[model samples]
Target: MMFMMFSPYSFLFFSTYMLFMFSLFNITNFYYYWSVMELMMLLFMGLSYTLFVSSYSQLMVYFLIQTLSSFMLLVFYIYNLPSLLTMAFLMKLSMFPFFMWYINLIYKFPNFMLWLASTLHKLPPMLMIKLFSLELNTNILWLSIVLTVLFSGVMMLMVLDLRLLLVLSSIGNNSWFLLSQMVNMFVFLFFLVIYSFSLFFLLNSFKGMSKPSLVSSMSSNPYALTLWVLSISGMPPFPVFFGKMLVILSLLMTVDMNYFFMLFLVMNSLMVMGYLQSVMKYFIYIYSSNIHYMLKY
Candidate 1:
């Protein structure tokens, strides 16, 4: 039913992503972990769809579901109405200030579970935010956007572990998706697909190498490494580049595009580019040496 509800292109994209996950991690080794996370994600998505269906108004659906979930947890007894819903949504996304759990999960969980947590698990909450955002305050939205971008960018720069770097990158990408919601839904979906594909190949590269200290040193296949770097950086010619271009063009068309917002976008783009430059430079260093010399370091 959910498959039918999604547009054909989106449905195909989701199906392909699932297939990539299954193929990347042989099912037998991670069967139990995969099944549990899949069930939880399904339940979350199901409830979101139910809410969307039950109420004609998107805002009312968000309010009612958020309230009901809170009541179930006895939150209604302790918190005011607005706080209840606010806390629920923040918890749902594991957003700023409440994001410690999310970071810990990424740092501790096995690759299979971390994949779900950092990617597919974000979909339901993000979908609800997109649907119910019609009347969301623009000022508050922009504030959250700025915080998300800044926080994620800082974490990405600070993280040394390759997996942790990917986790922070995923968070930044999620923020970009949220920003895309304000611009264009089609572009958002396209961006999601590109990110998923890039992540899949990047993770594949990680599996082939043992060292987690240096991503370029660890990537045995330079071609795959280059593709992953280019795609994530949203460099020209990649599908991600087109997706990002559409988002930027859409944002430019918006009447509310202020200098501050434009400056933020430029900074975010530069941050991503800086990371990619370092990755590529390291890859060049590795490639310049003999295999033994590269591996020794």
Candidate 2:
């Protein structure tokens, strides 16, 4: 593979340059858009190397490149490009539905790389709020929010893997919550930190278990996974809960309460019940005589 032939640093440099060229050539007319595209492209290219390249020495370079590119993009948005800024903003945010690339990357990359992806890529959406005038169209914002929430919720429900579910649910809830604008900004940040930390811990904790245990824990046990899923789904007390609370608060303030509230409650409750049933089945497995057979090699 080309990845194995070149040193990570060399490969990263080459990739970055290539991406720069692609963006430059494509956006000849739209110079501002081209620049933003190139910057994001560079960050994405760097992310690929950071994840795939085996060399630890290249880590700092990769991070530095990503950070600098991101900073430049942010400054450009804040200053020069107000018209297509929101599009650039959405691209940067990597929010749900608009997030297929990110989710695919997460699935392909190792867990540790999630740190860089989550931290660096999360800024664009947050910064978008600052660029918007108070009079910006609420309908488009709400539509995006609703779609993100529903799609994420359904995807989480369907996904057999907890990590994937968590990823989807987090994106969904956070996108909707951000749209609501009811919660203080600090609360959203705090929730994100806590949720991310918890996911890291949960994933690491199950590392010692056998393959079957891991699979069953993810697939068969409703009771065992209940807390984990609920926490991720923003049920209550968990950090995501605050995000959902803010979203709900926003909906109450702006939209028709009856329909939105019903939709929110019903969807969330279904997710909760789905995880609950799975957890309950897992616990029931503990008491079954076939448990030994299930655990046996």
Candidate 3:
């Protein structure tokens, strides 16, 4: 099961390496669209399993591809080369006006797969953001911030499923928190622990209730649902809540008041909405007459 889930990501890395190599020698178009960035990302996940063919060779190739693609994008942005470069960066980062691939990918993947992709694959973009922010003007930073928040907000509003909505909300929150620049290794490690625990609990509960021919057990199994929901929602007592709070505090300390406030409110509001929707849906399913119907063959 784990292998099946991670196969796409490895395959994607391999394919991205191939594409990057192709781009290096074929210099006709020095610039490419942001959509190419999205395609590279898609390919990375879609080809994740290819790593098994030759782990050492493939891993080296994957790293090289990632490095080259990243460098090219950086040069494009740093040189103030062209709008296409900025667009490519935006696409790579899954920002607005080029966010369709992100939404579609999340919808297609299972909750666990979605979490893996979002959390693990975010390193490149985060590195890029850190690099760019150090060199770019405040205007560019703010623009990137606005686009990320808006794109996430819109997707959260549109997605009906609880998992996908949470994923979207997480992306927005991650973007806003990252802009703060005060986030350190300890904070990231803590967030990882909390996120992993919550996701594990949720997946376990889902599996428990999804047993064949079993009626929806989430409501009757309030303890399980409550634990999962509270952890995921970043409610008090969970590491995520404290981590997120610190991130907001850091944002307040680093960025302007207005930008911090705007991002904080929007991201938190979406999270709250997603939590409420999840709770409501579970309750509805629990109380509905169709519960038995859903479970029956």
Which ranges of candidate 1 are over 4 A from the true structure? 1-39, 42-87, 133-135, 208-217, 277-281, 284-297
Clashes of 3: 16
Candidate of highest TM-score: 1
> Each prediction's Cα lDDT score?
0.56, 0.51, 0.54
Whichever of 2 and 3 has more lDDT, that candidate is 3
Q: After superposition, how far is residue 193 of candidate 3 from its true place, in Å?
A: 4.4
lDDT of 3 at 116: 49
Q: Which of 1 and 3 is the better model by TM-score?
A: 1
lDDT of 1 by residue, 1-297 (tens): 123334455455445555544442233332343343344444434433332322334434433444444343244323434444444555555555455556654444434334545666555445544544423445555555666667777776665455676666666666677767666557667777777777666765665311122454456676766677677767778777788778878888874778657756855764485557557556657666768686898
List candidate 2 segments past 4 Å from native. Answer: 1-48, 51-88, 115-120, 131-136, 180-183, 208-226, 246-266, 270-274, 277-297
Residue 167 shift from truth in candidate 2, angstroms: 2.7
Root-mean-square deviation of every model: 11.9, 9.5, 8.8
What is the lDDT for 296 in model 3? 82
Greater-TM-score candidate between 2 and 3: 3
